[model samples]
Target: MIDLAKVDYQVILLPPSGGKINITDLIDAWTHEEMEDQISAKVTLSLKNVKREDGWMHQHVFLDKRLVLEATDGNGWREIFRGSVKAWKTDSENHTVHVVAYDPNYNITISKEHYYFKGGKTAAASIKEIASEQGIPIGVIDGPNKPLTKKLYKNSIANTMMERLKESERKGSGKYIIRSTKGKLSCLKEGNNSVIYELDDWTTESSSDERSIEKLITKVKIYGNSKGDARPKVEAVKTGKTEFGTTQEILYKSDFDNMKAANEAAAEILKEDGKPEINRPLIHPDIPWIRKGDKVRVNSGTINTMCIVKSVSRDMHSKKMMLQLKE
Candidate 1:
């Protein structure tokens, strides 16, 4: 970035007899050596305490005839000017910085004629009038009447409304809705009912049941007071049989859905054998199958006696066996 404070130049004005000043000439000078082609340079002209008929002293930077930066003491920094920097050029001597200003009115002007190296040689005039005469647009810097393209204005308003709606939704004051038409979908909200709607077709036809508008609101809201990392807290639940060999259950104070999900997951794990195949419970067509906490008679390889099913196991080898009475 080129420092504006370091760049040196002279300010000059056109002779009264000279035709309208050419803004391009000034832009070329400021950006001559630095930019390959004519480019906008932010040139700040400081007019300390000098008052203009428009009731203010102005400091301004212009790009070509476009006013890119401007300030005034009259409006107390509240009323200022704005424009684009089109391009810059310099005089034959390379001593003056000629700036062009484009106002909100679409008027283009060569506002500053000659910038002189020595301060006192430059003529004094109302920056606003100079801007106006040069066809440079004048406007309040931070004023509400600043110009905006139609599209920009519309989009800005829409964004602002959406922001307000999101704020209301965070407070639970409104809901989100979706509407679809001919396969096109639009999501919006209704403030009166505090509900959101999803419509099918622009005709308000809904393909699905009317759901709470909040449900349609983006699961996460962006750009508002609700703008934070508010995430749902989850607690891990212990599922399956406890160390004591008893089925375990957990009662969750919050997140009932999470609790249900945990239970389901645990059930899946229990379905898979936790022990080796040799210790897994055996399935037989003739012998009665005994369940946990059940006693049964067993006869296997000289071992014949009654035993309780302590546990069972299955391994990747696909073998199954039961833990009979511990000898």
Candidate 2:
């Protein structure tokens, strides 16, 4: 078994000048966290003033320079994060500098452009093309191949990518997740994490069950435009009386031209949002490699079920982490 207390983190700096530097000794603190809904994993580091080849360390650290964090337990090293430095603040008086970075997808989030995707292709195919064009390295890509019929056009690359990902599930395909680490992009089926961990010991503490009622949907109205229709009209309506009464959702899509198509869309939403209860546990010991979308099976006492990690927050210094799980 790996000793958790023996874990040590190292910060490596890759300057634009084309060389690697070990700047771990200059770090004061650092944190790494990511969310399932977000498009990027975030990293923040605080550095102390130190002498370097180019002058004081702050002078050499500039935007877009690569920053990497890695950890080891005397066995080789595993990367925690690797991305370009997006922003920094040099505090001369305090002799310190603060830096923030995101997984290579940062550019995609800010870039806007028009893209044309032909029909008969899956959203996963389009997403792969985008990632490739943007130079994001590809990893495991198992996103569903359900073909897309909806038109996609001008929008922020991030927004457009997110829309396409959502389209997979919106059109009867299963849920999918897109994530990046060390500049490598991965798209896979939700809850299908390749690495599985078993949680059976008392190292975990249970947290309150969360009822995500805000996402609950019992009624749906899909509006679609027809060939002769001057304006879009309700193509179909789906309803199921819940305890909270009518919680409505309105969707306007150009492809929902008939009631049959519209009703299927409505049913899909209801099936996903019908269950509001989403539970999470507070895991004590840190599991550095356990990231969002990773699967874990809990077999401690009364709890025995497989779950997918929903989110993770980790302190680079201590290797401490907290996890949120979705069953």
Candidate 3:
């Protein structure tokens, strides 16, 4: 078994000048968070009156330099984050420099343009194309192939793309994920993590609360455009109650021209309700490659089910991993 206390972290810096600097010796404390969308890290180092080679402040050269964090045992190393330095600051009295970095995707800005995607491809392909256009690297894709209809990106492609992806997730299609270590994006159809955390050993602890009502929807009404009528009316409704309850969601997608597609959309929207309670657990497991979208089955006294990993935060110095779990 790998020893958690033996795990180590190293920061590799590549400035514009093209040489690498190992900042492990200067770091005092570090923290990094890996999310489904992005990865970020912050390092605090003690550098006294450090100057740059170009006769400028040391912090200036690191403003946009490439930063990479890795975890290593005696055998080899594994990259955890890959991004450019975004901002930095120095403490006047402590002589400590605080540096923050984000994944390469954060640096990409979509150019405003009129864009439309003609159907006939998978959503993963569309997402990959969008990321390529924006200069973001493609990591892993685990999504289903659904005929993408007319998708429009008017002012900001990033905002529109993210919204559409989230909408797809709400429909229980797949998950769109962004990793920082390689600055890559991926779409996952289901949990890909093979690591299992058995809660029976008391190593995995869970804190969850179930809600009384979870956005229950008993009615679905779909409407399509009319030929001659000015305003469109309801075309069809689910064979159930028509009255609104305390918790109800109404889905109206005019783009769906057929009742079959519209009904499917309504069912997808309603699936978001009545899900298992999400929880965050601090797991001290001796494992590697614990990341978002990893699948693990929990067998404990209270809970025994499979869940997908949502977020992972690690402190290399402390040797602890806080994981966010979702059903």
Write down the lDDT of every candidate, Cα atoms only.
0.27, 0.77, 0.61
Model 1 backbone overlap count: 52
Query: TM-score for all predictions?
Result: 0.15, 0.88, 0.80
Candidate of highest lDDT = 2
Count backbone overlaps in model 2.
Answer: 0
Residue-pair clashes per candidate: 52, 0, 4
User: Where does candidate 3 stray beyond 4 Å?
Assistant: 36-61, 108-114, 167-172, 194-201, 205-218, 226-231, 239-246, 275-277, 283-288, 299-301
Q: Highest TM-score: which candidate?
A: 2
Ordered from best to worst TM-score, the candidate numbers read: 2, 3, 1
Tell me how far candidate 1 lies from the true structure as C-alpha RMSD in angstroms: 33.9
lDDT of 1 by residue, 1-327 (tens): 112122222233232343222222233222111010111112333222233443322223333333322212222222122334444444345344344432242221121133112211111122233334544333321111111111111233223223333322322333332211111222323222222221112221111111122212111111112226765343444343333344333323231123443344334334332211122122221111222323444444333444433332211111122232321
lDDT of 2: 0.77
Comparing 1 and 3 on TM-score, the stronger one:
3
TM-score of 1: 0.15
Model 3, poorest ten-residue lDDT window?
39-48
Ranking of all candidate structures by their lDDT, best first: 2, 3, 1
lDDT of 3 at 159: 59
The digit string of per-residue lDDT tens for model 3 on 121-237 reads 556667677778877777776654555556666765555556556555644565665444466755555476555544443554444523334445665667666568565677776
User: How far is each candidate from the true structure, as Cα RMSD in Å?
Assistant: 33.9, 2.8, 4.0
Candidate 2 stretches greater than 4 Å from native: 224-233, 256-261, 279-283, 299-304
